[model samples]
Target: MITKYKLYFLTLVVSLLLLGCASKQNFIDKSKSITKETYTYHTFENKNKLQLDFYQSINYKNTKPLILYVHGGGFSGGARDENYIKNYCSKMAKNGFAVASISYRLTMKKLGFGCNTEASLKKEAFIKASEDISYATKYLIDNKKKFNIDTTKIILVGSSAGAEAILNLAYVYENKILAKEFKYAGVIAMAGAITSIEKISTKRAIPTLLFHGTKDKLVPYNVAPHHYCKKNKKGYLQLYGSKAIANKLKELNTSYNLYTIQNGNHSWNSKPMFVYFREMISFIDHQVLQSKYQQKEVVKKISDYTSTDL
Candidate 1:
């Protein structure tokens, strides 16, 4: 009952399926060399354990810089196992850095404080996330020996809401007892903002690298509401975007590098992953790894500046 054409079609289908499976397997196998381990960084009162996934390169001999990557989900729903996060972390590991993707407490549904304004609610969400980041940092520091982490070269890398949290952790909370314990080498904020520029100070300044799309609607490229709503709008808080932060750093005579994607939307990572990665690695090399902190006045617009110029 089998015609030649039917048999040929069936054979082709099977071949395609086999090829697809082989490609998938190959992809998985390629990343298998990067060892992954999970650890409980925090335990909430409800017995929920916050965990982080750390990726380490097997071939690297000496201790490596630690990069704590925070996923962005608008403060609601992202995970350490997200494909993008995993892939980014894996690439970072291969580049001779120990990378960790973390799961922090989210505040998407409701504000922690009852009967609070939109701005206050947003602030509370950021504060909660920052607290989690702090705890995760402490956990890593405590287990630095086990993870072979170079405490002197620790960097916080975050995207969107996660970026907001790390910015707060690095600047706003710097005076706090918990934050003072650790001296971070640098911070990478992708499409992130802060509630106020007052959080940034000369004494607590650290070299920062920022990547933001000019037309980002969710988080402003310049400055806008927390979710890009109008000022004083209900359920939305005003925020200072990367541009503002860079300007503040410039005013304080601190070191910072800003990358702007002209006419690009919020998903700059999708198309420019390699570009951002190269710039970030270069920043780490010069600003953090090489210990270069030239606090020159940032004259031109950040978009006009190149990585080499920084």
Candidate 2:
């Protein structure tokens, strides 16, 4: 009972609807296993809130590893969602590791010095941000069962100023000497500083991976032209190469790697980032941390990991 033109229009409308549904279904399929749930831990109701976005593993896990991300914005100018880490988190989650993009109290809020400390209140800022990171860790630790996490296998991954937080956490979490409640599997730093390496005298060896661009304009590859060799073996890698850092690690009898990207940009999400990520995953998958007391347990295992050392 319909005209030919009317019937044709109805058919086209149905085709368009089918296409729309298909497009949505494709997105669901791609991001299906990758969780993008934003868990609000604290609601400040318009003020600063401590939040966490969880990325879930799709396959290959009865239990999962967690990689917690601390975004870089120098402790004041960024959020957990800043710099679009969700994309990277999605990739990692899809690859079967649980990912968390975390929000910490901006240094200003912690210090109650918001817009007041104009002259770069760095020392205090680092302390406050570090505290925020620990709180996030405590949150995870307390909810380990709910999150279905391996409490023993948490990795603190931070960038830029957030690196300050990671280093501080590593130092404190050792010895349970500082009201320690959480334990970490490893730590990863992207453009992070090895602050207070001198204070690190504990035998609790945590595996560390440092990634930095050689041509970085900010957070220079070398701390100071004069202060390179004497203090930082990592810095010397920029001028010399990976072999220099590896040799230093061999000399110190520590486990680490420094990958210096030639002509890499400071903020660009380039090849260096993925290379860094891959190295970290390999380290985690290999489970490089054996307690100082567990030598007998992993002595044979270490020999098996010839690709990493030998």
In terms of lDDT, the best-performing candidate is 1
lDDT of 2 at 227: 19
* lDDT against true structure, model 1: 0.74
Per-candidate local distance difference test: 0.74, 0.55
Candidate 2 C-alpha lDDT tens digits along 94-122: 55567788887676544432223332355
Question: Which stretches in model 1 have alpha-carbon errors above 4 Å?
Answer: 1-28, 110-117, 174-179, 269-272, 294-310
Model 2: lDDT to the true structure? 0.55
Model 1: how far residue 160 lies from native, Å: 0.7
What TM-score against the true fold does each predicted structure earn?
Answer: 0.81, 0.66
lDDT by residue (199-232, candidate 1, tens digit) is: 6888778999887888887788787775566555
List the pairs of residues colliding in candidate 1: none
